[model samples]
Target: MRAHYRGWEEGDGPLLAAVTVLGRTGPQVHFDGIPLIGRPVTAVETDITRHVTDNNLGLRFASRGDLGLYGLGVWVRSARVGDTSVSEARIGAEEWEEE
Candidate 1:
């Protein structure tokens, strides 16, 4: 998984992001990025095996700043069962705003 933060300003606070797979003892990874000072960050867990039961994937983001007008992009790549190649297909995307 990869995450990118864009349009960061000078006063914006650093953002904390984490990814977790349900039933797992710990998160896949947790990272922080400061606006105007951070680059794209990637997290990988190669030991995770495909589960036969239902599993939940979680994403969490937090910051002390108001987070005004910033762009966040997250990409998750995985290979299909029995497929050796990974697909770059995007599942969905949307824009949001707060009043």
Candidate 2:
């Protein structure tokens, strides 16, 4: 599954956000097209990471098909637009799910 968040606006400068994920050990997490966690050989239950971008933030997760009963939970810890703190923005929260 893939989750993309775009909350930055004009003159926002740089936005920084943090997210926590709860899932099985097999899921891979990526931020801004870069691998952040979920190494193939390591197993972990949760991941807390941060990302900074000017206008767009991208989050992606990948797992093997054979892993049955797949589930993932994402929590927005905090978000900042420039120097102002803003509420968590989930414009297309449901878009993360597969059709």
Candidate 3:
């Protein structure tokens, strides 16, 4: 699966990116490896500026059986590291696949 960020905060900060499927307890998949069932997902921390729409954040997986359609939810959290801090977040999702 793949995700794109069309709009983003104007400046740099610690960034958190995650995706979840409806009805699931955690993130949809892992960002660094082939995904399998029952593995826990973690938020990826990175530079927010790299998340533009052209730089697709994606995941790959191996499913043993037929997979049905499901909704995808994307979340982004940004936090400025300082004594007086600022934080921002956004969430979006859609019915994302067909089989």
Clashing residue pairs for model 3: none
Model 1 TM-score? 0.20
The alpha-carbon RMSD values of the candidates against the true structure, listed in the order shown, are: 14.4, 16.4, 16.4
| Arranged by lDDT, best first | 2, 3, 1
- Give the Cα-based TM-score of candidate 3 against the true structure: 0.18
Q: Write the per-residue lDDT of candidate 3 for residues 1-99, one digit (tens) a residue.
A: 222334356686433343323222324333224232222222232322233223554422214222211233333322333433222222333432211
For each candidate, how many residue pairs have backbone atoms clashing (under 3 Å)? Answer: 0, 0, 0
lDDT of 1: 0.25
Best by lDDT: 2
lDDT of each structure?
0.25, 0.31, 0.30
Question: Candidate 3, 35: how far from true, in Å?
Answer: 18
- Worst 10-residue stretch by lDDT in candidate 2? 64-73
Candidate 3 — what's its lDDT? Answer: 0.30
- Candidate 3 residue runs with Cα over 4 Å from true position: 1-43, 46-71, 83-89, 95-99
Model 2, span 1-99: residue lDDT tens: 224444577887434332333222314454335333333221111222233223344344434211111123332222334554322211223334321
Q: Which runs of model 1 end up more than 4 angstroms from their true locations?
A: 13-84, 88-99
